[model samples]
Target: MKTLILFVALVGYTQALSYSDVLEEEWNRFQLDYTKFYQTEDEALLRRLIFVDNKRRIDKHNRRFMAGKESYEMGVNQFTDLLPKEFQSQMLSSLNITEAEGLIDFRYTAPRDVDPPSSIDWRARGAVTPVMDQGENCGSCWAFATTGTLEGQTFLKTGRLVSLSEQNLIDCSNDAPYYNEGCKGGLELNALMYIMHKGIDTESSYPYRGTQQKCRFNSSNIGASVEAFIGVSGEANLAAATAFHGPVSVRVDSEGMQSYKGGVYNNPNCSDEILDHAMVVVGYGNDKSGGDYWLVKNSWGTTWGENGYIRMSRNRNNQCGIATIAVFPIV
Candidate 1:
């Protein structure tokens, strides 16, 4: 009996060691160091949980890989390993965004020559598209997407790039009827409405805190304004709108987006079930293999996707709900 007990303990120890080795390799590959979360032995259990969670993620990634069906790379990066699910839902969900019942109807007066070229990138056209940014842990993707489209439009109209304030919308947009939740979430449409009714301030005036705060917008410090907004449909309309405007904000079923690394992201699991996350479509192009893709600008910073953006599979009948809830602000 003593020998059997000893043998069981040895097996348990080997399993733990194997898990530790695999966790270390994943951390190294993703350039993470969870040791920073340690201050006490009780707190150190977080490391164990993280290690376990990373293993779970690895198993999931491997399954996707083994199926020979992965269109994007999966990694144990910040988004996949750290961000909480409740926070992601709060950040992404604006409460039945696909309803489209109260959507505003506005006539567009854009340049007649709106037919986009084979491909167009507003960043390369001397537009002041700012560098990629992070929203931390707040359910503030709505604010980020709102500010991104605003920044792009400001540059397109004035020929000057200016980083607008997501913090401003996070603080002040609660006044919007549609923006019921402050930090928890807000609709990009409501954000555009706030900008139209009350102009937005710059990032310098109201830096992002990634959380809810009392409204403190300065009217004198307004930086950008949206003259009107337009709803777009299909690949052709979205592409044309992007070329005529700058960036278009769209909501997508991004439940599977965190694990994505690069390539034309087309996960069979992600469907148009609902619109959860808001993003800006900056441009579109076809790959070498003629796979059409939408260049989407994400707010998760530069380390997340192909440098803070994703080339999602486009023209696949609106795969991943890319154009389901799409719109762009007219500056």
Candidate 2:
């Protein structure tokens, strides 16, 4: 009887030890997987795990990865001293700038009626057009976004749409007292200001081969021009957007935008503040679901959003910063 009792106790102890060993192995494996996954910082995987599972573990990892990427890019730019001297001064001054947080509330204003015949439609006026992209791996979004809007406006006004070089703004705009390097973000307003003051040339005159190049200023044939800059207030901007025929520049929170799939994103329940990023507003209308959405064009490749664009909720001032910033009609 004594021997049997001792044997039973030993077996139980061994089984418990084996179970602990298995658990420890799993924990280590999970740690390894997480490190490798986040090291690459794949946006698609982060979106899938974050939205589908609401996995807090993965969310923490994603934020770390994004921070790492931002830090790495900033460090590289700093080491190389890639930005123009003038832009660095401006970026340092604007470091504390932040956009409004939470949902914005306002009334929609009816759009102004501009006669179609009297105005030139840039979209219809051109046979060939320049392709635009979001400045990924670089903080040159302001340069790209502003150049795109001007390109369209130039086409409408002059009936000749020329591909304006972004490299000019990247290198030359630094001459302004407030400009920053391509690593730190900048405002589209400043970009336009640079064009009006310095005079921007055509892409052929100053091509964007990427990387920092010598400053080339050709004041003689600065192809395009800006008529005016119209600032919109609150949610009312949506109504103002529909009336315009050409592109309008606006800000948006693009942090999680990398993973957005097809859906009418309406979550008044989120607690965290959204990050502000700029994008072009191309068109707006109601969709098949009988819900109104704004047709927005993004800089990320077409595979990212609804073919490089998204139809955000028009009624709510979320998704893109629809209620914030100003939209202008290039007269």
Candidate 3:
């Protein structure tokens, strides 16, 4: 009896070791896939631990999805290693728009009175450029969002889809009246106003460095210039504006998107009062099973969500502030 008990204990110890080995292998593979390089061994170990914990949560969430208890699925991506707070501070911008700022006066023009189509996709209309990756530790989503709206407007006007420079806004747009603080954080309205004043440069002329630097904006290489901007509110108005205009810049609470993989995303934690990340509304449609969803383009890269896009819950009382602050530039 004593021998049998000892053998059982040994088997349990071996099983624990096997589980540890598998987790280590997974950590190694994740690092290799993402090209993650840690500056110190201690940092790498801490990241590995965080990765394991995140993986566990992701697996549990997926299980719930499989059981039809959840609408969306969560999976591992580049953000699996970072803690939630760390991810928010690094990726999301600190949006501090006062109530007065929210009030759009003469600038906010309603779209032409016409019923919008059942669905609309700006990408299919030869407007949207390819998805872009905003590198880690940078809160410059506002720049990307602003550029996307301008890129669409430019295409519609010039019959050419030219990618504009987010780096230009990041480096040059931080000043009075339009204070876009480069990677630290910024606002789409401010970036758009800066472009309206000083025409933007092309992405090829001024490439993205993922960091703020000395302004290298050249007026000679102007890619697109914004004449003015129009703001709209409410689900019906946002849809109408997107259908008539090109992609619209909007803000949302992006905390729920850290590990988002696929499916129509909806989280109770998402609120319009805490809009932290900016993105572009490329299209909107209804998922029969998932209900209505707004197809949004994120700047986190092609590997992040549905090829750098997310289908956010739409027409559900303005989930994630999709209609709270929507604006589009007129090129």
Candidate 4:
């Protein structure tokens, strides 16, 4: 009987150690420090903490990629295990869309060149386009998108690049007339409206905390303002916005964006009118393969595609809603 009890104890210990080994492997595969999740060395608890569902999703992702079911590349990413589907929705479509917001029009202009530049990357053109930002666990992507466009406009107007504060909008816009959802989510139009009424402060003054907090805006410390913001809903308008102004904020259906590691993402399941995730169109460009693509700046940080950028397939009937819900702030 004692020998049997000792054998059971040994088996239990081996099982616990196995769980810890798998957990540690997954943690390292995700490139995340387990210390960030928890400092405790309780292997059993850590095994339960790891997202098993993501393991399932990762398996499916790899299967589809291997079978040529995905148009884009897939890899173990920062968000691979940390985010769930509901979290993805919160990250993308936190804004309540309204007709009033969509009907706003622009006095559109045609591209000066009969053939627009084959490649235009504002990042290389010396704009105060801020470095790629990480929204982290917060649903503050709307604020990041707003601040990105504001920075572009600020650069165009002052010839100086300034990294503006998304936190200022997240913390303060709740009381503003724009009906901001605060950190939960917000619309670019409402953000622009908030900026028009009350100018936004700089990142230095009110840095991003990646979560909602109390309003602490000092009107006296305003960093940027827009002369006006116009909304457009087509490929021609997006082209005009990029050529006439700088980067423009737009939304597209981010159905399969979570696993998007690299490549010209062309998802058939993506929605064109159901605008969800907000990003910026810095310019339109072509790849070396002669394929046309839109140069977009994402707020998912430098670790994401093309170093915080995504080259989206362009002129494909506004593929992924790239043409729909396009708006820009003019400084």
Candidate 5:
């Protein structure tokens, strides 16, 4: 019986070592996948701790998803090493409504009363440009959102789908009045105003650096110019405007979207009042299984969500404030 007990203890020790080895392999794989670098070993250890915790939560969430308890799934991504607060500080920023002193209201430029289709995708219509990555630790989602909306509108007006410059807005719009602070944070309406005053250039002409620098906007290389922009209100109005005009820029609470993988996102923890991130509403549709959803375009790269997009719960009391401060450029 002593030999039997010794054999059981050996098996337990072997299993424990195997678990540790697997965890170390996962950490190594994560670092390699995201190209993670640290200034010191201590910092790397701290980040590993955070990443492991995030991985645990992701596994738990995905388990719930597989069990049909969750509407969406969570997975390890580039954001796995950062805490929620760290991720928010590095990636998210809310729009300041108090700064909007002079901008067109939705009531004035609202689309004519028309029966919007049950579903509409601007991508299928050859209006939206390809999804873009905002890069690491940059809160330039507003710039991407602005460019996306303009690209769609430009396509509709000029019959050309041109990728506009986010770097142009990131650099130039940071000055007084516009207040678009590059990677720090910015407002979408402020960005629109900047585009109206100084026409933006093409993405190829002014590539994205994901950093704040001196304004180098060349008016001669302007890609698309807009006469004015309007701030839309309500989900119905937002849907109509997107269907009629094209993609619309909007803000939302992206607090729990860090590890989001796919499916109709319906986070009960997400607040509708706290709009923290800017994205474009590319389209909307009713999922046969997941119910109604707003197809949103995120700038977190193609590896983040559904090919750099998220299907947010829509028409459910303005889930995540998607329709709170929507705006679109008029070409």
Candidate 6:
């Protein structure tokens, strides 16, 4: 009987060690997979991986990346609450949680029905800029989109043109909690709100690093200040286009964006699901096709679209709340 008991103990110890080994192996694989996935242009698998419910699998991957750091411990509790309950358990069982919260939220809103600025010159509009591609494993899109729009608008306003740093908004912006970190998804209006409330520092003051870091406080504010905010009901009104002179923040669908490669995108077959991504409308007019399109500045990078912007069809009643919240920058 003693011999049998000893044998059982040995087996249990081996089982425990095997479990540990499996986790270590999986952790290594997770890192390699993540790097390869991000570096390559192939997004078919990535789109599947990101949109699917794989909280536990992702938690393990995050743990491996954040191993041996103080942030890891903090991530343990934070990630638990952030992941769905089922995923939390699966991740905790195999790996230590390091980074818990996702940056993007599907729900948020801007102030409603404000008028757009009228100073915008539709004739002066330039070619669509390149698409700004936000690499995977990062969530600085809000800052990028905000800065991208600001850059175009500034170019239209001054004609000198300057590339505003999205990284500034990612790191700085004290108006909203999510703005503090680019890891969490944020809205363009939030950046505008910060600019209006606190004033913005120049791109030279705050450069775009493409990653999250500590914020540098500026003593002098530079961007236009907003006096009031209003909500509009539909997209057909000329008021929506007028708001472009100021910051007109709008939300649109961005799910299949990973595959977007430039075109007059107006596919009725595509899903109508709208993403929380925001952009600034620099100008609007009837395209050569006579279809009304809003000249939108994007943050993906200059390599993607018409330079770095897209011409989305407007007048669908602001289908996804694109015309809902328009803010005029107090000139």
Clashing pairs in 2: 87-174, 87-179, 87-180, 90-178, 134-299
Model 2, global lDDT: 0.51
Please give the distance, in angstroms, between residue 122's alpha carbon in candidate 3 and its true position after superposition.
1.1
Off by over 4 Å in 1: 1-20, 25-47, 50-56, 59-68, 82-87, 98-101, 107-115, 131-134, 176-178
- Please write out the lDDT profile of model 4 over residues 1-331, one tens digit for every residue: 9999999999997877864487567766554532345456685354445455566565677677667775456545556555556557546654445653553656455555664555676777666365555455567777877888788888888888888888898888886367777656778788888888889998888888877889889887789997788776678767767866788888888777775677677676677877768888888876654257888888877677767777788877888888777787878
TM-score on alpha carbons, each prediction:
0.82, 0.59, 0.91, 0.81, 0.91, 0.54
Q: Flag regions of model 6 displaced more than 4 Å.
A: 1-135, 148-162, 174-181, 220-230, 238-240, 243-247, 269-273, 288-290, 317-321, 326-328
Which runs in model 4 stand beyond 4 Å of their true positions?
1-24, 31-71, 100-114, 132-134, 288-290
- Candidate 3 similarity to native, TM-score: 0.91
Instruction: Identify the runs in model 3 with alpha carbons over 4 angstroms from their true place.
Output: 1-22, 99-103, 107-113
Q: lDDT per residue, candidate 2, 222-281, as tens digits?
A: 766655555554544544543444666666554333444444433343212343455665
Q: Which stretches of candidate 5 lie over 4 Å from their true place?
A: 1-21, 106-113
- Write candidate 5's Cα lDDT for 193-304 as tens digits: 8888889999999999988877888989899988888788789888888888889998999988999999999986777778889999999999876789999999999989
Q: After superposition, how far is residue 63 of candidate 5 from its true place, in Å?
A: 1.2
Q: What is the Cα-based TM-score of model 5? A: 0.91
